[model samples]
Target: MVQLDLIELADLVRPEQLVAEILRQNPQMPVPVPLEDLARLAGISKIEAFTSEGFEGALIANATKSQGAIFYSNRGPRPRQRFTIGHELGHFLLPWHRQAKFQCTAEDITSGGNKDWEIQANQFAAELLIPAPLVKTRLQKLKDPELAHIMALRDEFETSMEMTARRVVELSEYACAVIFSKDNVVRYPVWSPYFTHRLCVKKGERLPAKSPSREAASDPDEWHELDAHWWLVERRGEDTPESVYEQTLVQENGHKVTLLTYDPE
Candidate 1:
């Protein structure tokens, strides 16, 4: 069993470093080896597809610290499968994650779980697919921040819109955030601390009416900004008043991105 301080390991292992370590362990491994191969390198051998009672996937037992089981339902899109596998792998590798099994759902991968581990796993997955340094260089080269640019990065990194949006929000300087909605209701929103305190969209609540997201036939490609009060609830007794700007991206596939901004007052 390899000994590692989980927190220290988390901090020490950059995505590239982890990938390189996998390659070193599996010398004959193919470049861009399938995610399964990486899992095996981490001591997970059994990859089974079955119907999960309530979880999308799980990793059961790691006594040897070199072998475990990975299970996922044979459902959903390929990206979702990849995400589930990645999520389980995260549990297996994180030293602090000690459980007989880890049960994860679709929302669990994106929205559920404690904030720190969820964020850590998310950061791990993001770094594994799209290294921050490379994305930073790309953002530097392309000064214009547009939805089209995000699509380009998605292609370049071979990741989903959600992954690309999170990284973009991190790299972008213009007080931006990404709000995901389903059936016209907000599911989760990720924002920078600068813009967090002022954001008004409530979880599980319907989107604002005046926003382009409410339009019957809205173009997901364009961005439109509106006043802060349109989305945020007002403070009843606060002395200082604040406002936010919103940009909407209604994906043709049904997902939405609401980019919120605030003028540095």
Candidate 2:
């Protein structure tokens, strides 16, 4: 079992290293390596599901060389399947990961960061697919940031929409946030340090009745700027202090993704 910290793992095999090693192993393609190839390189044998129910995914036990398998239900989208496989691979490689066959839900893979181990697995999966260095390089090329840029990155890297959005919120030079809400209730949100101190959006809080998320049901652009207190708690009888850039993305199932972006006032 290899033991190392997050920074050490980042130093050892970044996304570029992973890509380079994949290409070296399979010279037929210069584009990003396939997920199966990534699994094979990481020593996982096969990715298949058990004849079981109520399981989103799992890792097979007792494989040689600490290797494992990734099991998933067939009902998910292709991008989700790829993300699940990457998450399971994270468990397989990280020494601090639990040994049990991980049965994950969509929420688990997306918002399971309350625990240290779960957070580590999430970081591992993110870095494995879209290294921060690559993202940083790409961000350098763009003058204006938007959801289109994130989507382009996702398609370029062949990763999922959620992963791309999360990465952008993490790496954006602008003050940015990505809120995941279902049924108009807050689920999970990734925020920058600027928002961390003052912009507190509590879990399960209903969307602000006056926010664009409630009324802007038609615009599907990449980004927008709006009032700050519109999404933050306002002091009673105080004038609205700041404004924020609000980018709203509505999924097929009424899931709302609102990206709050603002510069320090």
Candidate 3:
């Protein structure tokens, strides 16, 4: 792995800028970026498992944030641990994430909500590990956006479904959204910038019974169509698309992912 010079990258403030600079410098950086090495070069002294209660990950750094060590839980798959390291590294690299210690829960690792710092850190981590340009290039090659395509890319990127799904939603030209659930309860929703309507399903709400994600069927991978109103809460002046395309991939331990798409028109 080619080492990055933090000094050369110090001027970048936003997560996108910092990630772009990193890729630019290491133009040959391989797919599924060598995150651990990148973290070390960025001054993370160590990345080790921490089994402490209530925290999935933590970062402890010196007063000026020159150096630090990341302790992430061993609870989930390796992909999640890698993401945690990337997330904490975001805390270390971004000048404004100045806390001497950071303790992150699974929710923090998963969704940052309106907390700008948490949001930024998660942004940094996703971009660092998955690299948006790579994702876009791959999307361009796919004939259509679907759960199957994202699933293949997820394995190729060696990332969790949440990371891969959100990245696709962020960059896909198709108007679309991704919902992540555990045991059929909506954990969060991520929609592309082009998707304008609000999904009726809020976080923690049970997915509508008619939704493909809630159905037990012979082919979970098949795309199903439903009235857009089933999933969307329409605004006062608009008509929700007559039908939206839905596909689901049930994951390990009842974790489920569903993708919704429609014509950009």
Best by lDDT: 3
Give me candidate 3's TM-score against the actual structure. Answer: 0.87
The estimated TM-scores of all candidates read 0.69, 0.75, 0.87
lDDT of 2: 0.66
Number of the predicted model whose TM-score against the real structure is largest:
3
lDDT, model 3: 0.86
lDDT of each: 0.65, 0.66, 0.86
Name every residue pair that clashes in candidate 2: 224-246, 225-245, 226-244, 228-243
Backbone clashes in model 1, listed as residue pairs:
228-244
**Cα-based lDDT at residue 161, candidate 1:** 77
Candidate 1 global lDDT: 0.65
Per-residue alpha-carbon lDDT of candidate 2 for residues 139-238, written as tens digits (9 for 90 to 100): 8897355666777888887887778888877877766778888878888888755454355566888877667776537465745556677676677765
**Candidate 1 segments whose C-alpha is farther than 4 A from its true place:** 1-34, 46-48, 114-123, 193-197, 225-247, 251-254, 261-265
* Cα RMSDs, all models: 5.9, 5.7, 2.6
Candidate 2 segments exceeding 4 Å error: 1-33, 49-52, 61-68, 96-108, 113-118, 194-197, 222-225, 233-241
Residue 116 in model 3: lDDT: 86
